[model samples]
Target: MKPIFKLQNRKLIVIFGLFIIAELGIEIGFTFVSARTGFYFVLQFSILMATLFILFLIERSMNRTKQELTKNKQKLQNIFDTLDVAIWSHELSSDTLLITQGIEKLYGYSLEQFYEDKSLWKKVVVPEDMHIIEEREKKLSIGEPITSTYRIVRPDEEHRWILDRGIPIFDAKGNFVDFTSVLFDITHRKESEERYRSLVESLPDMIAVISRGKIDYINPAGFKLVGSSSAAQLIGQPVKAYLPAHVLEQIENEREEKKTFEFMLNRLDGKRIDVEMSAMPILYGGRSAHQVVVRDITQRKKAERTIQFMAYHDSLTELPNRYRFKQHLSRILNSEGDRTVAVMFLDLDRFKIINDTKGHTVGDQLLQKVSQRLQNTVGDEGMVSRQGGDEFIICMEDISKEKAAEVAQRLLDVFTSPIAIDNQEYFVTPSIGIGIYPEDGTDEETLIKHADTAMYLAKERGKNNFQFYSPELLDVSSRKMELEGGLRKALDNQEMILHYQPQVELETGKLVGVEALIRWLHPQNGLIPPAQFIPLAEETGLIVPLGKWVLRQACEQNKAWQDAGFPAIPISVNISVRQMDDEHFLGSVTEALEKTGLAPRYLDLEITESIMQNIERSTDILSRLKELGVRLSMDDFGTGYSSLSYLKHLPIDSIKIDKSFIDDINHPSNQGLMVKSIVDMGRNLNLALIAEGIEKEEQVSFLKRNSCAIGQGYYFSAPVTAEVMRKFLAEGFVSV
Candidate 1:
């Protein structure tokens, strides 16, 4: 469409042309007709009519143009109304602002308000975003295009995000004329962005965006994860600064796919931490980049290490366990070359006695001390491991039997000095046995077996010593195994028998009681002594049932003699610590007495001084026995290191001086004095004294002189069969 000014100028030119044409026509007619006959007048009238007609046509065309312009302006207004955008124009010449009706939809203001007050649009802009409008105005004054985004608050107190874009118009003289701008409502888009930012900021794991190998954006979690105080500290930093070169290369190589990796992350604080990272390709800032999420796994890694350590090491001593020791031995044996590998099997001597008496807490402490000593004694020479209980196995490669022996001696020597546990000095000793590779059998099992056998031999040969594996040791081990097997079946086969030893009054020469002793008569091996099989029973845990059998048998036999019209006498039955520790021990004793129809007063339960180790428990057990109307005597009284206070508290009717003291009672030295002191102490405590293992008359006389009344030994009669004991019972007295 043409401008109004141009249209008006065209009309004026047409009218002027028509006037010139009419004047020319009149002049030509006057010339041709000599100014007569009204010819000029007629010509002027026709030209004037033609000019008027042309003016009419021009006026009609201008009307049609105006109509079209109006229609087009209406269509543009409709288009602006359909979109969520407001269009406005400012004319610098007139100082006027023209805005579309859509301005009401965008700013909650009508066109009239904007026209009445151009500053109203500026006032609606949020205070923080007013700077954007000011900057855009400055750019527009310089004839520069304006494109800005800012927030605005409408008259209804509602906030909105606006995207304002404009193009500056200029005049022919290069002076700024006006600017037409379009404003779009972007509140929804801004809300979405805020939600996403909120989600990222609140996450516990780190989120980062990388562009061009540098950190483009990082969440709050990322800042904390990398030990950065602010975004400025981490932004624009190369991803390579945090990630290792290999990790970056891996991420770059697989940029198109999502992947996770676990590695040590170097923190900004110079501490390395375990981290799990997941990376995926993303469009950051409209360019291909990577988005990574990181999690710290330092605690998880530490827990894993702890679990792994627990799997291979003993919890109590922190030493390699039996499983680990076997693994070490197998590894050495598998790769053994022309070198001698010595496996030393060590068993703490009498460790069970200490463990049972002193309680497991002390036992555990002792074992820990032994483990530390073993490690120190064999430092760098071998690997020391606990084989459960008080047993330790050591492996030394490229060592000779002599070297092993020397190491074993060092181990024994280390324990020679007392170990201090809970303010108490304990004299613990180790009996170590050495087994050589290729000589003491080939494989781990055979070598360990040989070593164990030699250890038993060391124990048997008066403990606190070390011995090397020999063929002779295997024979002894085989005999022991045979004895253990035979002992298990002895009770069921009725191969066990009891012998009664007379307990006589040393001064009166009268038999008062008899001690029941267990004898195993192997069907094939003849009679086997208690020393040969009793320890085997205890080691195998068969003593609990065996002691019950002994108690019942002694009770039944004594009852039989009483029913047979013989003299009534109490029978002594030995009780093992294993039986004492049994939970049903009291029940067993009750059952034996009830089933045998034996009076409780005719029975005596013999306990050794070792019971004093657990004084409280011992007192309770002995007090209960005393309540059952049975006599309790402490056998081997002086051997167990029982304190005088312990003896005072225990409820015992008698104290049997152990044979070790009795054998030296006649000697003219401190030996007799020791026995005399024990007798005197027993007398003062109101405890009956009985001397065991008295074989000579002089020993008997010395015991009688010391006021020890009761005695049992060869001096009376050896442990006799029940049939022979009946004759002794009938005889009633033996000549002392």
Candidate 2:
């Protein structure tokens, strides 16, 4: 058949037809001359007939070939329309271009629309790919083939990757004129690759692939675990370099069905890590490759160790638990303890006070401080264990009774110096009890019991001390139990009473106020002074309710006196530090005032200086009380270790000098000097000062001359019942 390009010009096809006719005429003449005379006629007839038949066959074959070529061209046009790829053609000579119908669906632009403005192709190509396309096009000008992958922007504002293969079309003169190309849609393939990459990189565990005894590919997760930069750095590296010796053998012998192996691995940073690795051998890139997944177990192992520690040790003090302590004790007794072994039990005194008044946060801090001190005191010579809250046991091996006593003394001395927490200093004392091995009993149980019993004896003898174990001291434990049982019902039984001490104005001899002091009037025990039962009240947290009772009763008494036409004097009441820290403290005070109908100025609250100095939460309560116009006084002032800086800032109306100083007022020049200094400090700071426990007239005279605003002591009268005070007030003052 004829060439396809020849069909483009009808005149050229006509010229080809004429040339074929000319060649056929020459062939016919040559055939006639070559034949013999006898066969000339028949041969000529046959030849003419054959020539005609051949000529008809040639014309029919050409027509059939032309029909087949037209069908192929139609098929190609159909393919260009139906295929997902967009086909584009360009004339390099004229810079003209054409696009298929697929461009409208893919890029929201019709073929005709793109052909109208040939520059649309250049504009639609992504800016980053424009230079690349131009460079490839320049290569095609030098008779080079053009193939490139570029990002194209669709009319719908979508981006896609396209693999464009284009070839130059040359004229008869061998001059490049046009280019035809097929663009295959590669966006789905590119998107699939991106998704695969993200899936591998985002895996929680490390992943690696090895082929031909070398690591060929490792995902981003694997690179991070192996501490390498990229897969290129890892590829071609021997897999045995990172895996353990046993793991390497397992990898080579991967014929077994077992797919998982766990072992250690070395990172690029030269650190060994515990890893659980699973791998499978598979065909990859026409070669055997291993796909590995690894999970790091180092942190998990450390967490297990931490849980083990918590299971056997005290969290507060970081000391050995009783279980471990007992084990150590058994070993010590079995090995080499022929000499006496002392087990001392230490119980911290008034630790509950700090816990109740200052809060558990401060209490915990105080406990840590005490533990540090105990640890330092018993260093290297004994084993200390926390038996439980505020109770500790120290085992001193190879020691006599004398040595035990020495150790106990050393332990007691540790508390003499102050313990500071949160910028505040606290004084804590522990009552230590000692029980000697073999003397107190041979075994651990009996010795521990004896030591604990001795601790009870030490506490009974008064706190801040120590005692040795004895069989007789165990008897006192029964008494303590009985006391604990009775204390719960003491308040309900009405065994409590309040006695009023008159607080008169020092300048005017007039009864300006009365201080309410609580006394336990037990039915069988007679009158129990506050010094005896107040501590019990505080320790049992019965003080919060007890103090409230005292406040309500005291306020009612003052209100009754005022309603009865007696002179209305502000009644002072002592407050426990525990009451100050209660969250509902302000509500309690307001309720008391509203129930009693007593003016706020008619009530006074007496808090110890220690309470003011220790209570950080007191500011809110103090401010609330001042807002109500209630009088606030610091009781037992000189006895507290209050900072002068804080003393100047407290919201108080007055300061009461402690009874201790007043008792020794005349004993030395320094005692008088101390009283004078306090008086001067109070005056300088604009604080009203009251002196208590003034039994002698000389002390009273000294206080008066020093500008003390008030004085209360036996010099006037001891605390009396409320009825006696009402009678005494009506009958006028009774001198002692």
Candidate 3:
């Protein structure tokens, strides 16, 4: 290879070096060739072949170079087509430009359209960024390069963020040629940065960056939260100086340990703030910076305290609740002191009547008013708590039984005056029971039980009174319990029977009606009168069923008397308060009338004065019963506290004078005057008058002179069974 390349170069160089020599050589070579073989033409032919071979090699090299150039140009075109960036130039004089195809894809405009007017590129730039773009371009025109990010709007009205770098191309003579620029779509990158900035600024917590122990940056919220004019005022101020001593200690601890901390920070406005701050060390430009977030929790802490208080106190009266009271009771019971403690229980009598007749709104008002009155009456010696509806418990510490009684008496006195609720006057009485410490019982449970027993005893004796727990009271209650058990059995055994006492017309001396009274003819014990057990029956609700039995039996016996051709006198049966208010009272009466086939007029119902006053829903019930054509009489009148106004409104046909007035009829001065006045009042009110307990002739004379319509007592005839009463009625309404 070297030998061939050397021969060619040497021949060419020798020829060029000796052009004259080459010419003489050519002449000599021709003369020699002509002489040797007469071949001058052959020599010329050889020279021509050599020149043609060299031209052929030159043409081959040119073709290969052109093929390589074409390949490289294709590669450059592919690079421009695939690139996301657009490369372009602008000729400022003509305002015509060259833009890559990427410009068409990026701005939704054809490259030809963009190049048609160079100003189109400027117009595509968002108007908000137009001033900045122009200012930057001006900088670039003065031999400076420009690199900026600005928004450009596409044909679809979507805005894109682009990074543009441009430089002015100049000639060697320093004249401006064109603008050479590269544009890159940077919309995603710009959005990420904007999101980060917005999230930091929108936080509710106060966030700050402290570099080198001084404030460097803080969000806008931190300024208002830290009681500062601006971040500038806080900058350069030592972080330790802005915090309290405790907060400073916390911050230093957190910094040393590289941990988060929480504390209270007091602002310049005298407000104490509960803040939890998390601080981290961030490197900024090769220096350490602390980014802290402070959150205020003052309101949350206050709410926690409020919830805690509500759990321990009563919501209505704001007093120690039952839960707390039990805790106190247990503590007192466990103490080793000899101090006396009395637990008194007081229940308001007939409280439910007021609540039922009126409304619960009035009931609530009454409770509030009563609570105030009880608080004022107790003063400060004892604790009065509302045990429940219409019931209260008083705890008097270091008090004897007598002292406890006095306290209970004081409470009872508070209820003496009528209580007004919702413009309605109501009088309520209390039955109180007291149990003393170490005597009644040692523990709270036993003491409460004994107090309850004592309270019931007080109610039995009479309401508006207080009783101390005594052994005798317990014995009497036990006996009464035994009697109740016996009576319940007696009913099943058919030992309970009804007795009738004839009611005679004083003027006619003829039987008008008979009062059917209950008599428990015990198998062993002879007879139990109505006076002895009727009250107990009513209290225990035994009167409802027992009263029904009495009504049916009385109606049947009276009908039998009429069928037997005896006088058709009406029969009266007493109805207790409970029976009158029973839902089945009217049904029971109708059933009895149907069974006995007794007319309603011949079946009279006698209700006591007290029962009439307190019967629940009496207005409609009484009126309905009156519509049934049954006789209604008020028994034991002038004994109960009845309002004359209400009495006149009742659907009663007659008033039976109580036995108390009849018992004292011999003392004419007072008793006679009372009976005369009652009879006159009843007559004037158009109510029939019946004087009961007329045992003496003098009493009969007094009642007859007072114009009493009827009289019945042991003097006329005692309560006898239907068999004995039949014989007596057959004997003209007299005793056999």
Best candidate (score: lDDT): 1
Worst 10 residues of 3 by lDDT: 1-10
lDDT by residue (331-430, candidate 2, tens digit) is: 7777863677899999998676555435568888888888889999999889989888789999989888998898899999989888888886777799
Clash total of candidate 3: 0
Q: Is candidate 2 or candidate 3 better by lDDT?
A: 2
Off by over 4 Å in 2: 1-83, 86-127, 130-148, 153-159, 165-182, 188-373, 381-406, 413-430, 434-464, 468-495, 501-513, 535-569, 575-602, 607-630, 634-652, 655-736
- For candidate 2, what is the TM-score? 0.58
Listed per candidate, the RMSD to the true structure in angstroms reads: 9.1, 9.0, 12.2
lDDT for each residue of candidate 1 in 1-736, tens digit (9 for 90 to 100): 2365676787788778877887787788778976476776777788778878887888898879877777997887788787788988888887767787898999988778888888888888889887888899899889889789998898889999989998999999997878799988989999999999999999999999887879999998888988889878899999898899998988878758998999999889998889999999999878898999999999999999888887888889999988888898888888936778999999887566556446678889988888899999999999999888888899999998888888888888888788889886676788888899989988999999999988888888988998899998767778888888888899999999999999988777788999999999899999999999988988999999999999999999999999999999999999988889898999999999999999999999999777766777878888998899989998887666466777787888998887867765664433576688788888899999888898998898788776788899997789989999998899898764
Per-residue lDDT of candidate 3, residues 638-678 (tens digit): 65545567778889899898886677678633466667767
Model 3 segments more than 4 A misplaced = 1-106, 117-316, 336-338, 349-362, 377-380, 412-429, 480-484, 498-594, 598-736
Better of 2 and 3 by TM-score: 2
Candidate 2: deviation at residue 730, Å?
9.4
In candidate 1, the residue pairs with backbone N, CA or C atoms under 3 Å apart (3 or more residues apart, or in different chains) clash, namely: none
